[model samples]
Target: MKIIKLNAIDSTNSFLKEMGQNSTLKNFTVVVTNNQEKGRGQVENKWISKPFKNLTFSVFTKDFDLEIKDQKYLNFAISLAIFNTLSNYKTPNLSIKWPNDILSANKKICGILIENNIKGTKITSSIIGIGLNVNQEKFADSLKNATSLKNSTNSKYDYDLDDLLLEIIENLKNTIHLLSLKKYQELETGYLNVLYKKNIPSMFKDRNDVLFMGKIIGISLYGNLQVELEDEIVKEFGLKEISFA
Candidate 1:
């Protein structure tokens, strides 16, 4: 349960990955930064980090079955962890978007990126990178979809970075421990309940630039997104083949 707090770092996820690669790191070991120089999101999208204003951290976990491609559940796991942490602040508007984005009143409150190092069925480690807009006052023009807790509360949501990390790390540990016992059906159901694109037929941009107005069915074990086409055809796709509008 050790946390490596940094005044600044290139990327929390990158740092944690390197840490695992260098040695045998324990589960729940976390890397946190008040300032990140380069933060990457899904599809190589850049996460604009505002120093001391946002929460950027990553946790290393070795407690997962690593089966069931429903990697979406992992997203559910981490989102639940964050949700449990933030919900304690009396923020009832906080919610999670599908595929792994946290939102407060439809504006992005945080983003998650999951990475894993696998050797066959054995995963040496998994990195859960999270970026939460905790205290930022404003975002750049490009991040118009983002919001922060400070903005939501109209009061300073600032806290000691070390303390915040400890809270999130504990939530993460408990989450994984439960999942280790196959007790994630409830969280997974909760995540799907709040999906941003549930039952709505919307245009999605696939990896090859293909567009489809499909309704999401659910997620497969491998984390492949299951979408039901308008023509009543069911198609499942991996991460390379899907993203929200």
Candidate 2:
């Protein structure tokens, strides 16, 4: 539970990973920064946050000895942890967009990026980066789907970032404990229960840019999105292969 607070950093994930490479890092060690100069998202997307107006942090943990095939459960655990934490704040219409984005009323408020250190089919450690838009009211026009806690709740008072971070970390620790106990079914069920757009007919665009209609049935064991097509075929799509249209 060691927390390292920084004024600014290139990326909390990068900083923590580099630190781990050089020395032993206690489990649940966290590195949080007020300004993340080069924060990253899934698939190399940049995580944009106003300085000191958001929660930008990375957590280091090596508590789970998960195999490569069971790694998706870790994703499920982390996503559910954030989902549970935000629910406590009464985040309206909170749901988990597949693979760990936290959405409120279908607009994203939080994003998680997990980097696992693997060796011989086992994940030895994990560096999890989280970016949560807290009090920022304005976003670039380009980020039309982005929203913040202030915008979502219209709260006049700013959220205490430190308190929110600690709450999320506590939830994360509890969820990961379930994983360590191999409660895979419980974790997956919790994740699917809050999954966005589940069982609703929706449009998607594949990497080929071809549009199609499908319903998100569930997620594959390996963390792929399972969509039921019009032809009654259920297909699993990996990241970057399909996106909501």
Candidate 3:
């Protein structure tokens, strides 16, 4: 794993994609930023942050030969890595929200955005971007739903940033390798156990912008949200279909 620490960037994913386009940047090449000026998330949602006060980076992965079923496990791996690292704070309350969000209590602590460059059913490469609210204290008015590690711990964690990142990368590497080997049952169990809204009747939006209440049955092998909705209709949702409340 190679880490490229940028002093500043519009978004680490964009930077890494630019790099991947030009060079033979192998899998696991990383582009990180102390401050991301214009970070983005799924559906082009803006990610706001205070400079140098959060964990923001992108991992460039070469996954050309991976089966489509194995691709979503990569998302699981990233969530697991963050969960494990945050566990060092002894906050067992940390959780993986369905479809790639990390939350503490009910507030967002991290967001994972997986973008792929694909040809047919195969992925040529993927940029897994993560923006974790690590050291921030105050959130903007619009981000009242956002919370940081400092908010969870009630005090700052005294840990080296580099060391924590190393831990995450190491876990991530092992996770992808494990999934590539097809040990998916283990991954699914761990992910479901830590899912934030798992088995809870909560609100989610459909493609029509209508809100409905459902319990998360767990994520599927293809990484869709398996939700048991009102009136007992069990539905599955991909990234484009279901949205969180």
Candidate 4:
């Protein structure tokens, strides 16, 4: 793995994507920054973190040859990798929110954004951007839902940043290997087992802003969320179609 460390940057994902376009970055090439300005998550959500207090990085993967139909497996694999890393740290209540957000005890601790390079119907490469709240203590009022490892655990983390980064990469390597071997069912099963709020009733808002209660059954093969609404009706909703209430 090639690692690039930056003191501050606009966005690690943007940097690595630009690099991937200009050069043949090796598989697992990582670009991490102490501070990320203008960092983004799914649906243009801004990720805010104090400089040098979190894990903000992007990784480039190449030549994976993943099928478009099974692309969500890649998302599950990456989420599982981060989940495993945090679980090792004894992070309380680690769970994967729908579409790959990492939560701890009902608070968000990590976000992942994956961009793929596709040729015809196969994914040739991917840029996996991750923003993990590590040691930050205070957050802006607008980020009330955000928490970090230090804040969640009530103890200071003295581990090196690269140590966690390398650990995630190692797990990612194993996941990618599974994808290469077409182990889709196994990966999906592992993902659902740790899925947040699965089989539990919760409140959600539909795209029209209507509030309703539903139970998460399982995600569809294409990664759409399946919710069993009142009256026992199950429906699938894609990204942006639903949000926690």
Best by lDDT: 2
Q: Summarize candidate 1's per-residue lDDT along 198-243 as a digit string, tens digits.
A: 6779898887787778988777766667889999898897765677
What value of lDDT does candidate 1 attain over all alpha carbons? Answer: 0.78
TM-score (all chains, Cα) for each model: 0.87, 0.99, 0.90, 0.97
Give residue 31's lDDT in candidate 1 (0 to 100).
87
In candidate 3, position 49 carries an lDDT of 80
For 1-245, candidate 3 gives per-residue lDDT tens digits of 79999999999999998887798897789888898999998888888888777888898877546666567776777788788778877653788887778888878988888888777776667788989887788888899999887788887464456776777788778777766676777877888899887888989988889898998997777778899988888898987787776
The order by descending TM-score is 2, 4, 3, 1
N/CA/C clash count, model 3: 0
Local accuracy by lDDT, each model: 0.78, 0.95, 0.81, 0.90
Q: Give the TM-score comparing model 3 with the true structure, all chains together.
A: 0.90
Candidate 4: where are CA atoms >4 Å away? none
True-structure RMSD, every candidate: 2.4, 0.7, 2.1, 1.1
Judging by TM-score against the true structure, name the best candidate: 2
Winner on TM-score between 1 and 3 is: 3
